[model samples]
Target: MAINTPPIAFGTDAPSSARGKQAGKARRPVPAPRPGLVTAAAAVVGVGLGATLALTITSETSSEFTGPGGVASFAGNLTGMAGSYLALVMVLLVSRIPFVEHVLGLDGLLRWHRRVAPWPISLLVAHAVLITIGYAQTAKTGTWHEVGTLLTRYPDMITAAVGLGLMCLAGVISIRAIRSRLRRETWWTVHLVMYLALAISFAHIIVLGPSFVGHPATQVVWSVAWAASAGLVLCYRVGLPVVRSIRHGLRVVEVRPEGPGVVSIVCSGRNLNRLAVSGGQFFCWRFLTRSHWWQAHPYSLSALPQPPYLRLTVKSVGDHSASLALLRPGTRVAVEGPYGTFTRHAQRHRRALLIAGGIGVTATRALLEDLPRAAQPVVLLRGTRQEDLVLREEVANLVRRRGGKLHELTGTREQQGLDEQSLPALVPDLLDRDIFVCGPEGFVADIVATARALGVPDEVIHYEAFAL
Candidate 1:
């Protein structure tokens, strides 16, 4: 009779977020916790609401209720004022500030920003509708006539109307059905107009809103908050990039084809290691050439950063991406990252699974070399065809040197299914390992679902999607 070795189960039945301990190995501490940035954000909203409520109550007690019109006016003022603050929050979230990004991660912050986006516009709409009706009732006039009067007769109202119009236009363009029809650059430019809309609308609030009347403290608070939000945007989104570009003097060094429609761009910069970026992180890169200088696209660092050098692998997904292959050597570059939590810091288990589909392999391949020696990760590359595999040889070499496994799944899901059961079958003890998934949205979603079905804990599964 031949002796048989027992099949290794990845981990015990502990929650994925929990630290796993081997029989003899001492457990390591989890990543340092950021000081409750989300909690702090929620608290700010709470405080704003409390103050708004106090102001409303004070005004209500001091005057007699004048019926539906009065109620409409009150609600309009309340919602409008609240909406302004919420818009400021949205601005702060997307400001690309390091502190907030560190705490919330780019993905978490963007998701929160999206969730809060419609609320401000919704509140603004309610403000306009209710205020129009209230004013119409008070003036004993039709709503349209009253609207015309407010636009023409009221102080700062005309500018506010224009601002509101711009806001409404942006909102309409942002609608998923409408937005998908427009180019990304077109959509981005229209979205930029919202800052002007917000600025112009603020004047109407300060000059006309009764809540700010005789309340110098409240006025100062609002002014400071708006100024701070704008300052962050100007500094991080504009000033810092220009400063970094000038200081680093990044220039294109090489552009090589990885596969059909895929290109690898290598750039050399001054003191690149000073950036303190990790392998799997990404930067919003802008190449300074006539046609391409105006728009920036976020591309992940496909290789580990070395002093004076960085590499980005891009698949032709848009006009900007397709133009990358044409980039000439020495073309100046500006960057605004390495912004994300997709790096080794996200890994929780020593045994890991790195999964990628198509162009997403860029990040995973970098991680294959970057993950700690103790991680012992398995890399799964998925593609429609063998030629679709980007960096195939490089990934295999990395896996070979790292003493890991590389499993390639080519062809359609119909031709080669990798459902919940098949995935576990391919990677034994899959439930015990931390899983990193990157791919097209639908493909990534199916993998995530499979991981969950295999009882993989949420904390051990890390993934980030680029929104640009």
Candidate 2:
């Protein structure tokens, strides 16, 4: 785990010039993202949610609310409907739907997911509390007694309680403090419990919910929506990856060191030219090995596909990443995506400013290759020391070939920082360029905030934050 750039070894790959020509011939053009489709999808989702709420409200009667525990019953029903709808929405957000993912990027989708997550869990908890109280009041018994009665007497109540427990566990572990302490694999495995939780909980809603219990139309609509969400998840998150992995048949060819704790894995695959991927997009790579096959980690390509060869650079930040350095050649690899919207396609201005912090240079390097020569890119590579600036020479060469400017900023953050003044000073024409940044979470946040404070429009300032 030394921090100096080492010569890259491609194993049995042909000469660079020959490979480039073949790669160009083999690579199919990836389509640009359509923001309009995303807008339309958002509208559809809003309408569906609204309809669900309306159905719940319309199903209630004035007489029902005037009875014992009526207020609590009504409130509980509303919260339950809203919470279940939002939970479904949460699932759809991370369902890896290609069109939505293309527009929002995985990072964007994840941000929305985290923000939306609390609502459903909180509402569902409230729903359980309020419902139990309502039932207790109606039965003229204590809340704890009603809870026991429901668990023992009501059909599907036990499974619903288990689902709620699983969902709560997922929510608790997702908190930043707790998540940081867990291994990525552990976190991911716990997160999958959410899918099971949602599934197990659905039966209770259909069987016991006031809105759907006696209403065939409402039941049909609700079932359809849930089924569709499940289908999308299966198609994009499960089926597509399986199909692509089989089609590509990618296998490790070499693992070469780039810098301290950094290694680039080259994989040879079939029909790689047919693999449509943008420059800055990442794939959830699953190495089919005894210790690693059960988990997949997202890593951006350090370089674009070179025909039969594709490369991803990873830093040893955790056990999964560290194990990559020891990956034997011929190890099978399964990839889930070429997902993300951080690409040249996102550029609005004719010129671009690409910024990389530490290991984030991996993404910036690949993205730089995709920029047009006229982009006149200004690349700023920031690192604690010169050695920490991985892939420096390659970035410099790419900059030079494109008539772009390359600046390396080395030292501690206190010594070499990109504040409001320093950032604009480094790229004097910052206002005229689309700024693309990739880095650790804090560094990316600082840069984004500085850019915003400098009056950079939100649309023109794009970034990806690398986190576990």
lDDT of 2 by residue, 1-468 (tens): 222232333322223332432444646778889999999999998998888788878888988788887789888989999999999999999998998999989888999999999999999999999999988888899999999999999999999999999999999999999998997778889999999999999999999998898898889989999999999999999999999999999988788887888888888888887889877878999999999998888899887677688889888987888989999888999999989888989999999999999989978988888788899999999999898888888788888888899999999999998999899899899999999999899999999999999999999999988863
Off by over 4 Å in 2: 1-26
Cα TM-score per model: 0.89, 0.93
Alpha-carbon local distance difference test for all models: 0.77, 0.88
Q: How many backbone clashes does candidate 1 have?
A: 0
lDDT of 1 by residue, 303-413 (tens): 765445567889998778898988887789998876777778777788889999889888887766668767777889999899889888888877776788999989988
RMSD of each: 9.5, 3.1
Model 2 clash pairs?
Answer: 2-260, 3-260
**Per-model tally of clashing residue pairs:** 0, 2
Cα-based lDDT at residue 128, candidate 1: 88
The whole-model C-alpha lDDT of candidate 2 against the native structure comes to 0.88
